[model samples]
Target: MKNTIYVLLLAFLTIPNLTAQDFSDIDKSPMDVTIIRNQNHSPMARVIYSRPSKNDRDIFGNLVPYGKVWRTGANEATEITIYNDMSISGQKIPAGTYSLYTIPNKTEWTIILNKNINIWGTASNYDSEKDLIRIKAPARTAAATIEDFSMAFQPIDNGANLLMGWDDTYVEIPFKNAE
Candidate 1:
């Protein structure tokens, strides 16, 4: 009997079981995608981000403090995937994936493209030197308040403009196809 108990305990400990738990009642942010396509109808660049709703909270000064590095979105460090080599804001960025960071201010926002892509938020492990490029984007006031954080790519001459908006604030990042 003792041997049977030991065997059963061992089997129970070694066996792997996964149980699904319902989390539908929890409030969660939804994932969003921003894609910049070429005239040929192919995606040249893309960003995978999480959209955090405002819910009447102050986004700029209170939620996201100025003079700090932000993830540019809600979660996962805001990944940027470049399908082709391009010149972004006078900087040559190679074809690869990168994490986008930004330092927001009243007048302008400094955009930082970093080599590190796997992260949670902000530049918590942010290394200034690891940044591939830094560019200044003028801050502008939107026509109306944007309840959800948003990112989109607007068409340009050869590439697209990366637009980010939240609350009543907005910024743009321009690029040109290098190929």
Candidate 2:
């Protein structure tokens, strides 16, 4: 009877430790944040966010619609906080964290940088006049479907090309940052 009790106790004690051991490697995983500066010739800037394309049925059309405020990407709004005032489409945007949104259309997409940042995706709190900058860019059909929505800033001669893509469509917005 004592031997059986001892074995049972040993099994119970070892199980928890083994489970912990399995997750011990998780702490060693690489962190997902990368801070880049002076990138693509734009000074005084930072990009704190990016997200993958959502494959759900309600993503492009049901979730994000035509001539509506989209949270830019999945999850939280694809936020970009700049440390200094910047120029977007010849409009001045002060340094701060702004909620990025878009109104997608067939021929052109309007990118809106709203002053509100803590709200949910496409919340009604968005004000049109409060927008710091509004830029229009043409959209093109892609040969493939982008399973995940993605955004990247590519450096050009005097400015950065903000690229957004998903589900066989891509758009680019160019802005020259103030020096």
Candidate 3:
């Protein structure tokens, strides 16, 4: 009985050290991201985003390939909000929150704006008819891999560019601010 107790205690003490070693090699890690729109302005929109780290892998043509549908982020589909009626990629969209998706190819990426806001990682629950807008954007390659996924809005003259990227893949969608 004493021997068994000693063995158990030894095992417990060693397990955590082993686990620490497993993660010690990683210098950086991924974290859930919070993105806010018009943070300094009134009536802003907020979104939460996250994705796995690059982990030294090539993102384009590897982790995420051409001619595939991506959830737009990690766990849940990337989300967005329109505080008021806005024009996206030349199409007008109403004010509300929506889930975003993308169909990627070599030349372009088709952005999908779905009405469903609450979902988990695509969830296989997408309804085609609920989609509010679809737009095409040119795909671009980055010189370096983005260790973690990122989404941000860059204010343009009359609109904003919704930028999404992880690793070497990136796509931008232009949306006009409500008038």
Winning model by TM-score: 1
lDDT-wise, the better of 2 and 3 is 3
Model 1: residue 93 alpha-carbon error in angstroms: 0.7
lDDT of 2 at 97: 77
Model 1: which ten-residue window has the lowest total lDDT?
Answer: 18-27
Clashing pairs in 2: 53-148, 53-149, 142-168, 146-167
TM-score list, all predictions: 0.83, 0.73, 0.74
lDDT of 1 by residue, 122-177 (tens): 64677777899999999999999999999999998888999999999999999789
Off by over 4 Å in 3: 1-40, 43-45
> How would you encode candidate 3's per-residue C-alpha lDDT over 32-112 as one tens digit per residue?
544435545654444566667777886666777666767776777777767767787678888889888787777789899
Q: How would you order the candidates by TM-score, starting with the best? A: 1, 3, 2
* Runs off by more than 4 Å, candidate 1: 1-27
Better of 1 and 3 by TM-score: 1
lDDT of 2: 0.68
TM-score attained by model 1:
0.83
Give one digit per residue, the lDDT tens place, for model 2 in 1-179: 99999999999987766544455654221212222346544455554444554555545556577778777765455566766666877788787877778888877888888777766555665667768778888888867877767666677665567777887678987656676
How many clashes in each candidate?
0, 4, 0
